[model samples]
Target: MDDSALLQFSRQILLPEFGIAGQTRLSDGCVVIVGLGGLGSAAAMYLAAAGVGKLILLDDDVVDLSNLQRQIAHDVNHIGILKVFSARDRLLALNPSCEVVAQPVRFVAHQADAWLAEADLVLDCCDNFATRFALNQVCCSAQIPLVSGAALGWSGQVCVFLYQSGQACYRCLFADHPESAATCSEHGIMSPLVGVIGSLQALEALKVLAQVGDTLHSRLLLFDGLHQTWRTVQVSADPACPVCSAADSP
Candidate 1:
């Protein structure tokens, strides 16, 4: 590591848990973020700021007036631009040293293998259950740690799936995607609520990357912004879970 780099992260290096070694590990790590909305916006920003070496961002949507309410990664001026491109510019502006790869295309299961294989860690910030399930399957197969988060209205949840340890994947939690559910756009979301969940998602991702604290593996953290309460629910691997079962086999 260069002397200037070390000096730049002097404050982080001072922490016993994240000394020079941990900082170096982070600097060399690669993280892939799917979706450039509320959750992705916050997670990507922090990861870049923390000196992650490489970031791969995926999002096919374009920024809109509504996105400015909570998608801090993009500003009003970026409206109509592809979300991935907007996020790339913002991250680069925050930390030019960090390499940002923008993929302004919708993520599909067929391409999950390549993306997950290349990432040291993956964050699922997508809006739909289909994408979330697809990402979970790919991450489980790749044995890559996946940090998943979701926000709807005033509630959100986050969890880390470490399939390498025979833990429950996202599919284990929700066997089938709910056919009827309200989205942030339909039901409306509290601007700050996304920030709370997104920030926590970023925290979980950092913890997983730095190996600093006990991760949320095998537990679901549910946050109720209106009630101002956080609840943890223990999750167990389903014996019949096709994805996790195959992951454990061989």
Candidate 2:
């Protein structure tokens, strides 16, 4: 790391657990973030500012006026443009040295391998179930850690799936999709709620990258914005889980 880069991240480097070594690891890490809305905005920006070497941004949606309420990585000038590109602009602005690969397309199964190639970690910030399930399956198969987060209607949740032996993958927690999964638009989301969850996702990602301190591995963190309370539940691997179980079995 150069003098300028070191000074730029001196605050993080000052942390006992996240010293220069951890900062170096972050500078050599690559993370794939699938979404550019509320959650993705915070995670991407924080990761970039923390000096993650590279970020693969995946999102096909265009920035809309409504997003200005919570998506901090975008602005009025970015309206009508692809979300990935908008986010990439902001990320680069935060850390020009950070390589931001903006893929203006939705995550698809056929292209999963290509999209996830060389990824040290992945952040599931997308709102829908299909993408979450797909990300969980791919991460499990590849043994890549996944930082999963969700926020809607004043409630948010975060979890880290290490995808290691005997560890739980996302499918273990949600065996089946919710019969009526709500979106931020439909159910109304608390703007700051996503920022809180997304920031936590970025924190977990940095811990996983630097191999420093304990992370949310195999644990579910629940945040109640309305009541301003928090709770954590241990998540166990589902023996009959279709995704992780199949991947683990011979």
Candidate 3:
């Protein structure tokens, strides 16, 4: 940690729990962020600013005009460009020392394991249940920590799964996809809602990496932006969950 580096993270290092040690951990951490949309936009920026050593950005989509409403990392200039590249450029601008790897690809079942091979933590900011379920399964099997966040229609939710024995994996909460899943285009989403959830995801990821403070581990946090209220509930491991059941976890 040089003088400039210390000065750059001085505010964070000032926290008693964080200090120099936590800052060091953050400077050495590597996080994989799936999805460079609204959620990933916020999470990735904060993580990069906080000095996470490396970030792997994954997203197969291209930036569109409609995305400007919430996706903060990209601008009009980035329209039609791959989301991963757009976010990578922003993250690098935030912290030049941070190594940014941009992968213009979606998270799929087959690539999950390989993508996360070197990840110290993963931020699940992607939409859709299939990717979420696959990420949960791979993270659980590998015993890696996962921070998942979702935002849709003035509401959002976040959960942290440490993948420890008895902890709740994502599949433990949503075993199957709903018959009528809402679409962002149809239902609409608030610009700030995803920011809130994404920021929380970043916070939880930092805590997990720095080993400081109580994270959202084994807990689900729900935010109702319309009502301006927050709720939290304990999540337990599903004994029969095929993804994280005792029989399946190593």
List the global CA lDDT of all models. Answer: 0.88, 0.94, 0.92
lDDT of 1: 0.88
Model 2 reaches what TM-score against the true structure? 0.98
List clashing residue pairs in candidate 2. Answer: none
Q: In angstroms, how far off is 83's CA in candidate 1? A: 0.8
Per-residue CA lDDT of model 3 for 97-146, tens digit only, reads 99999998889878777888889999999988878888888888788899
* Model 1, span 1-250: residue lDDT tens: 8897888778888999889887887888899999999989998998888888899999999999999999999998899999999999999998888999999888899977776666989989989988888898888878889999999888999999988656899999999788976788789988877778777877888778888978899999999988899999999999889889877877
TM-score for each candidate, following the candidate numbering: 0.96, 0.98, 0.97
Candidate 1 residue 217 C-alpha distance from true site, Å: 0.5
Candidate 3 residue pairs that clash: none
- TM for candidate 1 is 0.96
For candidate 2, write residues 111-216 as lDDT tens digits: 9999899799999999899999999988898888999999998999999998887888999999988777888888898789999999999999999999998998
By lDDT, the better pick of 2 and 3 is: 2
Error of 1 at 92 (Å): 0.8
How badly does each model clash, as a count of residue pairs?
0, 0, 0
